[model samples]
Target chain A: MIADLLTTVLVLAGLAFFAAGTLGLLRFPDVYTRLHALTKADNLGLGLVVLGLMLQAEGPAMIFKLALIWVLVLAAGATAAHMVAQRTWTHGEFERRE
Target chain B: MNLLLVAAAGFLLLTILFGLIRVLRGPGSGDRMLTAQLFGTSGVGILLLLGFALDQPALVDVALVFALLAVVAAVAFVRQHGLPEPAGTPMHENPVEEQPHDPPHNPPEDTHDR
Candidate 1:
């Protein structure tokens, strides 16, 4: 019962973060800031969701796989964020088209 | 518990839908790509939730693949377009000073060679 309760709270928290991230992505003024919003919030949200899921996993192997997915996402998200920021920094921001 | 998981997954799908608005209104390619990244992460969350809610372990493997592909898509975007300008271009305030020992101008040459 406790496990289920914790999962509910954690997963709901994760969903909140995902909503904030998407809001930031849509509302931010520029690419760099949007990158900041999307990458950090989304990955953290995924981590929390993964943590919640881990509690319900059937075995150690399943738990390990969940952890692995979170780590992979962290690495990939960081790298992609850096590359996008670098590209924007060097090439200049592209103008918004109406 | 299962209903909670399924609801969470549905909520995540809603977030993805919101992200698509950014893709449509985004000022630049980077912004659109960011939406794609958002989709990738959110998709993983949805799959995991559904897998547990529906009792299908195979969806976890699909989540694993989604995580891998997101980065690959970003890398490909960076490589295929919007590369930095040549060192001496007016884009940078002090390109030469910033990169004094930079390697020979090679992007164009490399493209030609390709």
Candidate 2:
């Protein structure tokens, strides 16, 4: 019962962050700021969701697997954001906005 | 518990729907690419939530694969869209490379010498 309650709260929080990230994507003025939104919020959001799922997961193996997926996502999100931002900066796309 | 998980997943789907608008209307490729990243991450979150909600653990593996693929996508984007830094704005200040008095880095020394 406690596990169910915890999962509910974590999942909802994760969803809220996802919503905020999407909102930032729509409302931010530039690509860099949007990257900020997507990377930061989505990373945390996914982390929380994964944690919530872990609570309900059966066996240590399943918990480990969930954690692994979240870590992979966190790394990928940071890497993708950096590479995309670097490309944009190098190409002067942001400058074009100004 | 199932209801909560499903509701959370549904909410994430809504965010993805909203993010699609940015992807469609973005003024720049960077914007689109990052928005796609948002999709990838959020998709993983939704999948994991649904996996638990539906009592299927294999979906977690699917999410792992998705995350790996997203990294590869970013790598490909970087490679395809890489731009040469402006002549004056060298990333490093090597004396051989950043000689302000010398000719710019373009045109090989041999080509210029000839």
Candidate 3:
């Protein structure tokens, strides 16, 4: 029962972050800030979800697999965020800001 | 527990759908591409949740693929479009600094007519 409760909390928290990230993406003023939303909030969202799922995961292999997915996402999300931010910077998207 | 997982999956899908707004109404290509990247990550989350909820471990592999391939798309976009001008030195400020062949010039009269 405790395991299920923990899982539910983690999952809900993760989903909330995802929702916040999406909302930020919609409402943010520019590409750079939007990148902030995607990188930070969404990444955390995925991490928590993975953790929640890991609790109920059956085998060692399944747990490892779930963890691997989170790690892969962390690496990929950070790299992509950097690249996009760099592109936006170089393109002078927000250069005019004082 | 299963129902909670299912609900989580549904919420994630809803977020992905919300992200589509940026993709659809892009003021810039970078924004569109970034939004797509967001989709990729959220999609992975949804897949994992669904996998556990439905008792199918195979879906994890699909999530892995989504995570891996997401980077490829962004890299391709950066390669093709190229980076924007570097910060700190506005191009207008130094027209002849790099391009000697072309002289420092102002916009055409018609362009400034507005």
Candidate 4:
């Protein structure tokens, strides 16, 4: 029962952050700010959801696999964010907003 | 029993949809790349959630492979063009900027007529 309750709460929390991230992507004024939102929140929100699922899933291998996936996602997502931000700036895509 | 996982799965799928919006309207290529990153992550979560809910072990490896692909995409972006340094971050707050210009170490060359 406790595991189920915990999973429920965590899932909701993860979803909240995920929503907040997308909202920021839409509402933020600039590319930098939008990257900030999407990179951090999306990575972290997905991490949390994976963790919650790990808590519920049986088998040590399964949990380990999910954990590995999260780590990979985090590394790749952050790197991609950096690259995109770099490319955008280099390409003069961001017009300085007042 | 399965309802919670299914609900979580739904939320993750919704997250994917939001990610699509970011990609579609991104102001630049960088934004598009990063938005693609989010989709990569969301996809892994979906696979895992489905695997767990269905008690299937096969999906875990698929998620792992997805993880590998995502990393490759990120590295490719970086290789083609290095990531942008964050604003206000001085890569090297050159103390040299504060120091006076140094004179040439070697003697000045003489212009002698041959």
Tens-digit lDDT track for model 3 on B13-109? 8888878888888888888888888889888998998998898889999998897788998988986676533344344365444455644453332
Top candidate on DockQ is 2
Q: How far is candidate 3 from the true structure (C-alpha RMSD, Å)?
A: 7.0
Which CAPRI level is candidate 3?
medium
Write down the RMSD of candidate 1 (Cα, Å). Answer: 7.6
Cα displacement (Å) at residue A51, model 3: 0.4
Lowest lDDT 10-mer window, candidate 3 chain A?
A: A89-98
Clash pairs, model 3 backbone: A90-B84, A90-B85, A91-B84
Local distance difference test values of all predictions, in order: 0.83, 0.80, 0.81, 0.72
* Per-prediction fnat: 0.74, 0.89, 0.81, 0.65
After superposition, the stretches of candidate 4 with alpha carbons farther than 4 Å from their true spots are A96-98, B81-114
- All candidates' chain B TM-scores are 0.73, 0.72, 0.71, 0.66
In model 3, which regions exceed 4 Å deviation?
A95-98, B84-114
The most accurate candidate by TM-score is 1
List TM-scores for all candidates, in order.
0.84, 0.83, 0.82, 0.75
Pairs in clash, predicted candidate 1: none
Candidate 3, residue A24: lDDT: 89
DockQ of each: 0.67, 0.68, 0.54, 0.47
Sliding window of 10 residues with minimal summed lDDT for model 4 chain B: B105-114
Which candidate, 3 or 4, would have the higher DockQ against the true structure? 3
TM-score of chain A, predicted model 1, versus the true chain A, to 2 decimals: 0.92
